[model samples]
Target: MADSQLALFSALISLLRRLGKLDDNIVLAYTLERGKKLSMLSLFYVSNVILALFALSGMNIPMYNAMRRCVPIASLLLGPCIYPQRTTSSIIMAIILITAGTITAAQGDLDFDFKSYTFGSLSVLTQALYLLTLQRMGSDNKLGSYKTSSAKTLTILYVNSVNCLPIVFAVVFLSGEYNSMKSYPHWSEPGFLFALGVVTSFACVFSYSIFLCTTVNSALTTACVGVIKSALTTIIGMYTFGGVAATPLLIIGQLINLSGGSLYTYEKYRLQKPASPKPTKKNSSIRPRKPKFTKTARNSSKTTF
Candidate 1:
């Protein structure tokens, strides 16, 4: 578990450096900037609920299957509805890229394999929805200009938690997933509390925390995270389950997925111009003044007349 966390931390640092935040001073600048002042209790409760919900989802193989079956439909529907105000071309491009990436990632799974295919499709779909929702909600500037990042993060987290409450309750009461609550568990134990703790912590930092910090440019973050998660999950699954190793098709698909993600990110960056450097106000040079020869010129003109 500790090793996994270390690996994730390393990945996060690599990402930050890629985003041009390698220097300690740059990181410190952001750290010192004014941030959303959210109450600890509110953050705690919301995070707990969100983690519990994910744990609940992990417990139910059947429910996961159901979500996989139904989620793609929702994902397909999400493409058109997000940011109705944005240009049609941009929206369509997003849909195309996401769909392509999803299909590429899901190619290795069995035919009609809802668990793998749907999960990949649904992940991309939900991410699009989340970005659209944030855009509609008007971001840091839109929602009354009160530095809304904190509030927005809190709201999304809370809403996610509330949405999954029924699932949590169902798993707790109906499935009895945690009956052996005190089992001495390694990280591999299926229903262990500590495993949940570690996984939730990783999700919070890697998934939710990044979402909060990079809400506006989330497409880039999502693309990076998606590729990493998909590749890593495939590698882990292959080694653990002793399946057919990743084939040439899978490799090609991964390359395409990464390329599409890069395109989307490049397009977004091109759309948003970076801030220009502020002009310096201090001028050291002085201009020469016109000589006081007005009187001499007037006398000379009168004499000549």
Candidate 2:
């Protein structure tokens, strides 16, 4: 349902761009020309959709959320290999801390299901791949013609939505989620319609937010946000969902994860921070000097004057 709304919103934005109502950061003609890149991007979108599905399939929400904390670690590790980028020692330590913390948190919940764990692992893997792919595409020189970050973001969103729409619809049709809708007591209720509208609006906003975050910032930053989001979700779940007991281990694990993530963020920022400009040296050898006259020459000139 949310996917459908995002697709619609993306389509509307594309239409506005075509009509000159919105800035066309992406060249529509060149968009199709990058066939290889577009195909890779399509795969990334499909993997992301699968990641969400896998997360949903996990039985234990908190445990599943804990597992997601590993995404940053996965991204950091895989990024160096896939993107051929260098990784710092601080980042390595951060990954270790995050992994240990995630394990500690999951240890508190002994009732683990193999299927849920498997899916959760798959989610982490796919998420890392998705982030790496986005980073690659965003940094590609071929797309550098799009000046604004917003243009790149919107272009990616537009392409991803178009590619995923058919798969989304097919899944909805096959899932039979709406098979017994007519049998419901209030299938056509105004309240239901209102709720759906609200959800769709929120989903559109969420999709845009995600795009902005990923496009403007590094992939690691997005993964950090995901960790923070999961932490917030866990806290909210404890109050709203009930049965979500915060064990001592869970608290410790959450702190460790947050600390490690914070350290990683700070380290990354420090490393990427622009170097201070050096002061320019004055041309000491080319200084203007006053002309000097000998005492005899000065006296002769004075006498003549």
Candidate 3:
């Protein structure tokens, strides 16, 4: 449903461009001599789509979310390796805390599936890479002239929608879902259609927000946002899903994760902060002196001259 909705949105945007209602330059910005940037954007979108599949694959929601808590740590570790950024002791400590919290949270779910764990780990890695790519793109001044962040986001969305169309169709065809749909005939159900629409709308908003966030902020900051999002999702799932429960360990883990994310955010902010300019010594020679008040001194000085 989400995939089809994005494809539809992309088609509409393309049609608008053809009709001269939208700017063609913005859509074609990445196509001109920016192969690396385009590849990153494609990877970002593909990994996210896969991540969504992993999340929806009947895994324990809280457990999956808890595993994703490692995103900040992964980004921090990969930062120096990928982008050669300096890491501080505070950041390392925060990463440790986050890891510990994730482990603690996972204790709540005793049934651990290896496939879900593998997918969750890949999702974290890909998400971190996506953020890193966005950071790199944002720092490149050359790309700045081509399009605004919003425009780049829209372009990426359009590309992703188009890119996934074939894969989605293939999956539907191979899985026999198309034939099953014809046999079951659920299209006429208003409730199901409405629910699907709501889900797709939410997914679109979420994807757009993520693109905007990564474009505007650093990868670490985006990871921090992910931490907050995961926490919220887990909390909501506890109430929305019957099997999900909030244990004491889970609560403690959440607090630890929040604290770690907050600490990392502060550390990153401090590191990136502009240094204050120092006060330079004033030149006494440049200042005009006050006039002498004593007449006798002035007269003596004139006589000597």
- What TM-score goes with each of the models? 0.51, 0.81, 0.78
Give the higher-TM-score candidate: 1 or 3. 3
Which portions of model 1 miss their true places by more than 4 Å?
1-82, 85-98, 110-131, 138-148, 159-167, 180-196, 213-215, 218-225, 232-244, 275-305
lDDT of 3 by residue, 1-305 (tens): 64566676667777888788788456643344454445665566567656656654756776777778888888888888666556789988887888888888877665667777777778888878877776666555433354577776666556656655666667668767678777876788999888877887787778778766766777777777688788878888878874566788888888888888788888988988999999999888887979866987877777552
Residue-wise lDDT of candidate 1 within 237-262, one digit each (tens)? 55664433466655555555545445
Best by TM-score: 2
Best-to-worst order by lDDT is 3, 2, 1
Candidate 3: regions farther than 4 A off = 29-37, 51-58, 141-144, 175-185, 268-297, 300-305
Question: Against the hidden true structure, what lDDT does model 2 obtain?
Answer: 0.72
Residue 85 in candidate 2, Cα distance off native in Å:
3.5
Best-first order by TM-score: 2, 3, 1
Clashes of 1: 0
